[model samples]
Target: MNLEECRKEIDRLDKELTNLLEQRMQVVAKVAAYKKANHMEIFDPRRERQVLDKIAAMAQYKELAPYLQKIYQCIMDESKNYEREYMKL
Candidate 1:
C-alpha cells in the first residue's frame, strides 16, 4: 500500500483502539470504586506482573513481546494514576 493508505489504516486502527481503551478505563473506574470502598491500595505488583506476562504471552508476534509489554506497562501506570485520582488518594 502507499504511504497515505498506510496512514489511513493506522488512523482506523487508532480509532478502534481509542474506543477499547475508553471501555477499559470505564472498568478501571469501577475497580477504583471497589478498592476505595474496601480501602485497598491502588497498586498491586502481583497483578501488574500477571497482566504483563499475560500480555506478552498473547502477543501474536514473538519479536514484539517486549514492545507490547512496555505498552502495557504504560497503560497499567496510567490506570493506577486514574484510580488514585478517582479515589482521591
Candidate 2:
C-alpha cells in the first residue's frame, strides 16, 4: 500500500480504537462507582500486574509484549486518575 493508504488505514483503526476506549471508560465509571460505594482505593497493584501479564501473554508477537504492556500501563494509569476524579478523591 502507498503511504496515503497506510495513513488512511491507521485513521480507520484509530476511530475504532476511540470507540472501544469510550466503552472501556464507561465500564471504568461503573467500577469507580462500585469502589466509591465500598470505600475501596482505586489503585490495585496486583490487578494491574495481572492485566499487564495477561495482555503480554495475549500478544501475538513476543516483541510486542513490552510495547503492549507500556500502552496498557498508561491506560490503567488514566483509569485510576478517572476513578479518583469521579470519586472526588
Candidate 3:
C-alpha cells in the first residue's frame, strides 16, 4: 500500500479507538453510579494493581509496552477522578 493509504488506515483506526474510549468512559460512568449508590470508594488499589499486573503480563509489544502501561495508568487515573466527581452528583 502507498504511504497515503497507510496514513488513512491509521486515521481510521485512531477514530475507532476514540469511539471505543468513549464507550469505556460510559462504562466507567456506570461504575461510578454504582459506587455512589453503594458508598464505595472511587479508586480501588487492589483493582488498580490487578489491572496493571495483567497489562504488564499481557502486553505483546515489548518495545511499546511501557508506553502502553503509561497510557493505561493515565486513563485509569482520569477515570477515577471522573468517578469521584460524578459520584458527588
lDDT of 3 by residue, 1-89 (tens): 99999999999999999999999999999999998899888889999888877888888987777787888999999999889888888
Please provide TM-scores, in order, for all candidate models, with all chains considered together: 0.97, 0.97, 0.84
Q: Which stretches of candidate 2 lie over 4 Å from their true place?
A: none
C-alpha lDDT of residue 83 in model 1: 96
Provide the lDDT at 82 for model 1: 97
lDDT of 2 by residue, 1-89 (tens): 99999999999999999999999999999999999999998999999999999999999998999999999999999999999899985
Ranking by lDDT: 1, 2, 3
Of candidates 3 and 2, the better by lDDT: 2
Model 3 CA deviation exceeding 4 Å by range: 1-6
TM-score quality measure for candidate 1: 0.97
lDDT of 1: 0.96
lDDT of each: 0.96, 0.95, 0.90
RMSD of each: 1.1, 1.1, 1.7
